[model samples]
Target: MSRVRVHNFAVSIDGFATGEGQSLDAPFGHAGTRLHEWFFGTRTFQQQVLGKPDGSTGADDAIARTWNDGIGAEIMGRNKFGPQRGPWEDHDWNGWWGPNPPFHTPAFILTHHPRPSVEMEGGTTFHFIDATPQEALRQAREAAGDLDVRIGGGPTTVRAFLAEDLVDHLHIVVVPIVLGRGERLWDGLEGLDQRFQVESVTTPSGVTHMTYTRP
Candidate 1:
């Protein structure tokens, strides 16, 4: 079976994955790009996300490069897809990632309101469905075939999968900042460390990269 993995997931020292006031303007809410500032400096992010040639080829880039490794499909919460809540008022808003998304595989969006799948340019077709974490993983795993399925997250989506013990490998980047308010990643998950063999390494960027792999 293909493994369920999360990569380059950033959280503050206080465990908040994203800040409050999420809207069309603020994708990470008030958190803005603070959580992912460590990533932006990497060559992997510069090339893959920003389509740039120059970036730091340091320790951060080494781990960030693994984000797309063997990932055949992705499962993200509706919030990660866009800020629109309730029924999607406008289908014209494809996603934050322009016409061509970075995910070169099928990306499933978990939402209460299911809509027809939106096919984008870079081989990413977004499928919206209302399902539990298990059900959504089943669909994503099926689409993934022999390759692994990635749990692309907002805090809620990652927390749900962690709560259900669905994740096989989790890579969390603990940024040094403290956001007192916002969506937290470790709210209900207590003793989560017991389930996985954990390892941590602090990079030159001042972020601690923690990997939790199931034993």
Candidate 2:
């Protein structure tokens, strides 16, 4: 059976996944690149994001490597794709990942206003849909076939799927920081830890890698 997973998502100590004022200028809002400092030095990110062959390897790299392993499809919120809002003011937004995206699978973008699918250089084809988290996951699962479906998110999207109890495995990296005001991940998720077997490990970089696996 294919599982729904969340990998390598980072959140601040204050529980904010993303800060206030998300726009083209600041994709991560005021939080900036602080949340992703750990991933930036990983071999997986170096190869995928920077198109480099060399990077740090170890516990962090091990976690990063899981990103593309068994994931056949991905579902993300509109904000994850870009900062454009309200019916996609311009149709030219090809996501923050440039021409060739890292996701080499059918990526479902959840938005209120749907648009035609956009095929990038790589195998990543963005499919925009206005549907419930369940509906979107259904399409992603169909595309994934025997492989797992990854929930690529911006907090809100991940929380939606979590609320629906649709996620099987969740890997979150808690970065030590305090984003006073922003979108929080643990909100409205009271006693969510009971649903999964949780394990936490502190990496050399001080980022705590927490994995939640549903039994």
Candidate 1 segments whose C-alpha is farther than 4 A from its true place: none
TM-score of each: 0.98, 0.98
The lDDT per prediction is: 0.94, 0.93
lDDT of 1 by residue, 49-168 (tens): 888899999889999899899999999999999988898786788889988899989999999989889899989999999999999999999999999999999999999999999999
**lDDT (Cα, tens digit) per residue for candidate 2, span 40-103:** 9999999988899999999999987897888999999999999888877778988999999999
Question: lDDT winner among the candidates?
Answer: 1
